[model samples]
Target: MYSFTGNGNPTLVGQLSLAAGGIGLNVSQDGKYVCVGGVASANLYVYSINYINTTATQALSNSIVFGNSALGSNYDLNVRGLSGAQIEIDGLVNYDNVN
Candidate 1:
């Protein structure tokens, strides 16, 4: 993650290493949380954003791993509201002979 000043260049704010390959990302409207969806791992990761002084930080808050790994690729993630931590993810799950 990075932050930009009014007249300065983008600065590195925070970073998180995912356990698997990440294919989708979404930030909450309030800028308090971020969601990362994995492709091969078939997992959803949630992180909480915190600010100390002026620098930003991210901490892993939650994660869910789905049983169907084929459904992991090419997904889109978005926050449902501005005040809540709800997320909406939509994608195609490649099942055997099905999409």
Candidate 2:
């Protein structure tokens, strides 16, 4: 990931890894989630971004040609929220929620 400043130069935020060669990627509109569609390993990795990216979940069990994903992790008051994932593979779409 890279951060952009007014100078128009991009600064490296950090580097993360995927299980296989990345073929497709998407960042959430809110900038909190990142997705990587990979070949070989054929897994869609969903990462939750705060300061460091954590593997929230993995989806799509095939050599993905193209894909997208979402992840959520949050807390407030004394309640803890569950993490979830949504993915759309080459042709099949699936939504999964985890607690």
Best candidate, TM-score = 1
Candidate achieving the largest lDDT: 1
How much is the lDDT of residue 10 in candidate 2? Answer: 66
TM-score, candidate number 2:
0.28
Total clashes for model 2: 0
Model 1 lDDT on a 0 to 1 scale: 0.48
Given candidate 2, what's the lDDT at residue 42? 77
Question: Which sections of candidate 1 miss by over 4 Å?
Answer: 1-22, 54-99
lDDT of 2 by residue, 38-72 (tens): 67767675564443223556643433112122333
Model 2 misplaced stretches (Cα beyond 4 Å): 1-22, 51-99
Question: Ten-residue segment with the worst summed lDDT in candidate 1?
Answer: 90-99
Q: What is the C-alpha lDDT of each candidate?
A: 0.48, 0.46
lDDT of 2 at 97: 31
lDDT of 2: 0.46
